[model samples]
Target: MIDQDHKLGVKEANLVSRKLQLSGIQGQEAEALVAEIEQQFGVDRVAYDPDAGTLAFSYDATHCNLDLVESILSKRGAGFATNWWNRTKRSYYRYVDQNIKDNAGYEPHCCNKVPRK
Candidate 1:
């Protein structure tokens, strides 16, 4: 696990990192976007590399996911690049986030804890 402090309301076990190549981000204006994302409930960390046009962030999948982040980006006139790799990754991210959410409340019911003779 990465040695870093997560933001309030973030669960370490549900933490997830995402790195996306974004389009239409104005230089310096990304700071506003970053600030907005940081204010979200489960966002742990966020950074935008203007030169690479990439946005990297970590959040608790149980509370925040890519869709929420994308909404904020869309409102700010930024979005993921339209490319095969990006699309594939975005789909995977969504799948994993959904899975995490689905399983967040699940509990294992195994008998391994029973005392042996």
Candidate 2:
């Protein structure tokens, strides 16, 4: 299968999907937040489920991270679930996002590609 290019700043190889239980906001407010997030660079897509109270999104980790989204949530009076599982996932997401961002500029060279001296 071939991987096609996604939105701006979003590469298929770097795409990540995340779903988080949300709190403190819903209905039109949640939709508004989703719209705001969707407008950000590197964000492939965003959706908020009112019934499940969860926000699911796809983004390119190398160009965008969870921190940027979280700031918007905080400012808009939304928050993640306080359960242990969600907390753990949040921490892991942060770690992976930072890792991707840190390595985004790195170019790997194969040993076989080196020219003979």
Candidate 3:
């Protein structure tokens, strides 16, 4: 009778608890391990959607000031040429250095003057 709603089944939970008990871990220490495992696997920014059967993810592109994220969002926006969410097929798109420089259509807002690091 292993309950599966808690991510881990009852048998697995019992095994893990037994192992922790054998290791002399009690109270907060044992609880901390369980919490850590849950957090590690649980989706924060990246995950797979079971209903959609698609991979969902997010990225912060500040490192290179890349425009891939912006482009994707723009394409997904209303009145755009493409609707990424409605597509049934998986598609891959990437930003290249050349595309950033040559594409006049992809003008990003610039501050003109950069502050000292």
Candidate with maximal lDDT: 1
| lDDT (tens digit, per residue) of candidate 3 on 5-70 | 434222222221100001223344433433332343321233323333333332222112213323
- Provide the clashing-pair count of each candidate structure: 0, 0, 0
Clash pairs (backbone) in predicted model 3: none
Model 1: CA > 4 A from native = 1-4, 112-117
Model 1 compared with the native: what TM-score? 0.89
Instruction: Answer with 1 or 2, whichever has the higher lDDT.
Output: 1
Ranking of predictions according to lDDT: 1, 2, 3
Candidate 3: regions farther than 4 A off:
1-44, 62-92, 96-117
State the lDDT of candidate 2 residue by residue for 1-117, as single tens digits: 123557777887778889999989968898789989999999998988888988999999987889899999999998888999899999999898888878878987788896657
Model 2, residue pairs in steric clash: none
Among all windows of ten consecutive residues in candidate 3, which has the lowest summed lDDT?
Answer: 13-22
- What TM-score would each prediction reach against the true structure? 0.89, 0.87, 0.21
Better of 1 and 2 by TM-score: 1
Per-residue lDDT tens digits of candidate 1, residues 57-107? 999999999999999989998899999999999999999999999999998
Mark the 10 consecutive residues where model 2 has the least summed lDDT.
1-10
- Supply the global lDDT for candidate 2: 0.88
